[model samples]
Target chain A: MDDDGRDRPPVPTGRSERARTAALEAALALAVELPYPQVTMEAIAARAGVGKATLYRRWRHRGALLVDAVAHRNARAAVGDGRIPDTGDLQADLSAVLRAVVDELAVPAWDALLRALCVEALVDTAVGAQVLEEVFAPQITLFARRFAAARATGHIDGSVGDVEAFELFVAPLFHRWQLRTGALDHAYADAVVRRGCRALSP
Target chain B: MDDDGRDRPPVPTGRSERARTAALEAALALAVELPYPQVTMEAIAARAGVGKATLYRRWRHRGALLVDAVAHRNARAAVGDGRIPDTGDLQADLSAVLRAVVDELAVPAWDALLRALCVEALVDTAVGAQVLEEVFAPQITLFARRFAAARATGHIDGSVGDVEAFELFVAPLFHRWQLRTGALDHAYADAVVRRGCRALSP
Candidate 1:
């Protein structure tokens, strides 16, 4: 869970939050521009214009830095990103939500952080669980609520449960993202929503 | 692409193939039994019952070893496992194919190799490309052919391409697998197939 701690450094405090954010933003930007292996503490410090000691005191190495960068971004995104637009039309609402996600994902910062986080999750169960709870669990819960509302309104049918409906709504986009199989666009989002409505409706 | 090769050794040859195979199998077995960091070269050699040099002469470190192990296993599984039973019923045939995949994925060796390869792919694009072509591409191709047949029989619509059909068929299982959000069993397989059939049918 600790990932050997040779990499994890001290926890960021209120005093260090701004400094840490700056450093992580620099780290994520650099990571997007270069390969993960090449994004080093010294380079991040240089880019952030923070003292090398500032980074070293908080992060022992690259892994901890990247993990926390993604974690931090995810936490911030979750604050306002969770609100799905409600049009009462389940298809439009779901497509709108998915397209919003594509927009969020298209950001260079989020893109790099997500790619790095997915890699870390694959290597470390602690990170994986962290993402599941902090990122996916909340989204899934919201989607479930939406689906239930839709079902009550005669949008989605009773054939599919909330869990299955949520999976149907979101899993395809995630699958494409992880596998690098295709593009995530408005057209793709609409297609998924259309297919999902057909499958989930009676 | 090379992943810094500080740990990469020479390529294994004809004489070393046997040695390499044994060591990789042992490595994969131990990987399944333990964490990635703990699955060391010394431990693999000990478990494999080969000289340490036999391992070092071929693989420089753990990543290289695990990647090769997964690549080898994927190559072998692709030969026979890609054949989906054609029952002439679209829903039944897809369920059978997905169930077969669930069975293959359930194996300890395959599970471990897959987890290892996914992590390696995150760190190395060369390994990622190799997996795409060697592992995913073949299966996707076969699924495309099957979907085409289903289409010819008026099962699936011309609205969705073979690629979209394949994605709809398989992405849910992968999403569940990667996220550990649900069980991958006969019921799960059937649910996914049922949803897919409804979504894609003419």
Candidate 2:
């Protein structure tokens, strides 16, 4: 949890942390209730029982705040939990982890939020960087560590590289979701792992 | 091909084909010279010496027109030539083909057009579907055919299935290009093929 990649802004102590959580909760509620275009800062402020000034002070704009809300949810507790179990079988471990990823992203609330932010991120460079930092940076770090451990255990070849090899697990899912090329389901998740693990086998 | 998937309306016999080609060239030339937002239908019409109404009758909007322009160029002859050689060595064949994909997609003109369309596609379903049809659909179909051929030759396992196996060839490339997580190059492209081949080997 180095400060370098931790995009989650530090919460203030005591009452402010509660307020931040309330604001985030309100943002998530609004995000699920309406299209992201309709989820406004004013609406969030009203829903959270806070002033617009409070939001501006923290996130600067609705997109930033929304990115934070969705990403914080994924990083902390929701879909995209980076805590994958190490069962010593690379194929099964990757398959299970990717299946969980599919499940997490499949949740309607998180999916909508994620899709909206992704669209905005494609258009806006700052938002694009936010996507990398908030959603993927931590999880990708965890992947590097996992891959290193897998390599050391002789489960996967050292040639898979430390970090880029993780792409085998995620890129296919992203390709399907981003391009609408196919269904993102358990079958697809396991297939990705199967091919990836096979490719990187010792 | 059948007109069902044809996004481009048929050019009338004689002079209309020339007009359509001019309009497409104008769109592509403008696409390279100016940002996508700056390159509009009005500008394209003036550049191509066609009326604004003519552009609208064919394409609903700028994004559709641009996607058609890029795809039409690719389909006619450009990047995404999936005419992979069957060297009987599936690994070498795949590596070569994937490397070509890397080169084709890396074209500055094509990349700019693709990237612009990608942002718009994320927000607009129509545009998103167009992205799949215009750019990826043909290649995916081609991939299925290749994998099937490989399976028959015993270069790959029979268990990999039809279309889902295609992801092994493409997902990593799409992931890198979309996320900017890493560079898309010949080395990376070859690595993807290597890993994919390993994963699917009997």
Candidate 3:
């Protein structure tokens, strides 16, 4: 059984899977176009070229549909490669990842979708927890692993735990993005990594 | 000539000033009691023991009322005492302020209200910008000033600029608080300041 709670189907994919994907894509597109409250089941079904009954059969309500749509969209970018790029220099690899995040936030659609999802999550606790777990937690774990690896290699100070070090590096990026205080750029990433590395120096 | 833009009736002391303070307090109290959507002019007025007409006389609507409430609630605590406590040690001062922030977050009503305001701000750009300016910007400026003072006193590396250093030190705290990832505690604060100070070392 896969993590999503169903066994992997054999090859020769059927129309049902295609329809499900289409429905999610349509829901995501609609979420971007309209506010969370306005993204109705009927609209999603119509956009997906499926019937309202079909959408209802799968999702109990608009919030559930939005949740599934966001989850599906986030799964595509789920961070998996566990290696922390121990090229004898921890700072360089960390800088590379932080810079990538800055670039990712520059994409308008990603920022819009994230902001919308955050707003919805604020109102709905369950949805917020699910997003933190499925969408945000995975990325955090990846960074934690890297930090742990750096600690093992003595590239980082032994006293600094994985979680603390990870927060030190990534928290700043999210803070800047969420608050819109300043630009998240390569220069900022470099400063964070350099400062973080120095802090961890034994 | 009060900060709220309301004409003062020159009350040397007594009921009118108290009434104004009570109205703002009621607005803040109502935000925690009900979500921003459920809060209304009538509810705030009733909570404040003032008439709806009185609330309208002061604030045009619920948005204005809530904005003023948030502004009043956070004003004093957010701004440092125009000094960064330069005890000839950069790390200690930074850690002290960061720890205070952790204590601030532990106040249950504060976090919930901040989340609500942030969510509303996303949807309403004007309110969002105003909150950032009136609330968050001043705090960031204070940290920047501290960094400048630290640099001038030779405690920190003069090479690091004020804004960059400020982001390095403060972003992580806001990031952790806003995301609800981990505990914002003294240990984490100390680590952040220690690491940041080291990185900024000339």
What TM-score number comes out for model 2? 0.89
Docking class of 1: acceptable
Clash pairs for candidate 3: A199-B195
Worst 10-residue lDDT window for candidate 3 chain B reads: B4-13
CA deviation > 4 Å runs, candidate 2: A1-19, A78-82, B1-12, B104-109
C-alpha lDDT score of every prediction, in listed order: 0.73, 0.78, 0.72
The parts of candidate 1 lying over 4 Å away from their true place are: A1-82, B1-75, B78-82
Give the candidates in order of lDDT, highest first.
Answer: 2, 1, 3
Q: Global lDDT for candidate 3?
A: 0.72
Instruction: Judging by lDDT against the true structure, name the best candidate.
Output: 2
What would the per-residue lDDT of candidate 1 be over residues A1-202, giving only the tens digit for each residue?
Answer: 2353221333556667668878978987887787666788888999988999999898766666776666555445643345565678889988888887788778765666677777777766666666666557656767877877877888777777766787886888887766666788888889999998999886
The better candidate by TM-score, 1 or 3, is 3
Local accuracy of candidate 2 as per-residue lDDT tens digits, A113-189: 77788766766668777777777776787778778889888888887665477888888898888788888899989
Ranked candidates, highest DockQ first: 2, 3, 1
Name the weakest run of 10 consecutive residues (lDDT summed) in model 1 chain B.
B1-10
Fnat of the models, one by one? 0.50, 0.71, 0.56
